[model samples]
Target: LAKTTQPISMDSYEGQEVNITCSHNNIATNDYITWYQQFPSQGPRFIIQGYKTKVTNEVASLFIPADRKSSTLSLPRVSLSDTAVYYCLVGERGQGGYNKLIFGAGTRLAVHP
Candidate 1:
């Protein structure tokens, strides 16, 4: 498994965009970097993923440098509803396809009025 480091908290007001970056210095060969978003009292939901380069979806864009050591998640036109803790996880976590070794301590995101 690869260890990850991310901000403990972030502050954002309404109508602004937020981008969070996570680093995994010792990322494994078979592992991939994935990002998740969580609202208060709710489980984290998948946002985007990438092994290298750029990946975009309805919610956010994932930018991974060629080094494959770190990645950034970009959320566009963020709203109060979008203000929430974001997490970056490496390794299978079972890939939602197998048994998972659960690890939790998700960052807290505060959305100011």
Candidate 2:
């Protein structure tokens, strides 16, 4: 498992674009970067996943550089409702004899009016 480093907290106003970067210096070659968002009193929800280059979805975009040492999660025009704790996770693609996935403390994002 790769160790993830991310901001403890971030502040932003409504309708602003927010980019959160996570660094995993020990990331493995077969590991994939995955982001999840968790709102107050709710379980973490999957946001995006990527191996390399860039991947975009209706919710967010993930940018992984060639080295795959770090990844960025971009949220477009974020609103107050988007305020949540975002987690950066790295894990193997297949079962590969690994039965559990580990998550970090998470990045707390506060969106204001």
Candidate 3:
């Protein structure tokens, strides 16, 4: 299993883009990088997932290098409502659910007006 590390906090203003990066030094061949976001009093929600290279969705984009040692979650034109605690996780999905998923301390993103 790979240990992940991320910044303790970040600050951004509305309409600006924010990129939170996580580093996983020992990522395994089968391990996949996933990002989650949690709002006040709400469970963490899925944001994006990637193995290598780049993956994009309606909400955000995830970029992974060929080495697969790190990943960046790019939020475009963030808004105040997007303020939340972002979690970077690494694991694989099993028949039951996510297996052996290791979560980091998380990055608290403060979106200013």
Query: Per-prediction RMSD in angstroms?
Result: 2.4, 1.2, 1.3
Candidate 2 — what's its lDDT? 0.92
lDDT of 1 by residue, 88-111 (tens): 888754655873433445566666
**lDDT winner among the candidates?**
2
Q: Which scores greater on lDDT, model 1 or model 3? A: 3
- Give the CA lDDT, 0 to 100, for residue 35 in model 1: 82
TM-score of 3: 0.94
Poorest lDDT segment (10 consecutive residues) of candidate 1: 99-108
* Candidates ranked, most accurate by lDDT first: 2, 3, 1
lDDT of 2 by residue, 1-113 (tens): 88899999999999999999999999998889999999999999988999999999999999999999999999999999999999999988777576346888999999999
Clashing pairs in 3: none
Model 2 root-mean-square deviation: 1.2
Instruction: By TM-score, rank the candidates, best first.
Output: 2, 3, 1
* Candidate 2, number of clashes: 0
How many backbone clashes does every candidate have? 0, 0, 0
Tens digits of per-residue lDDT for model 3 on 31-113? 88999999999989999989899999999999999998899999999999999999998877665764777667799999999
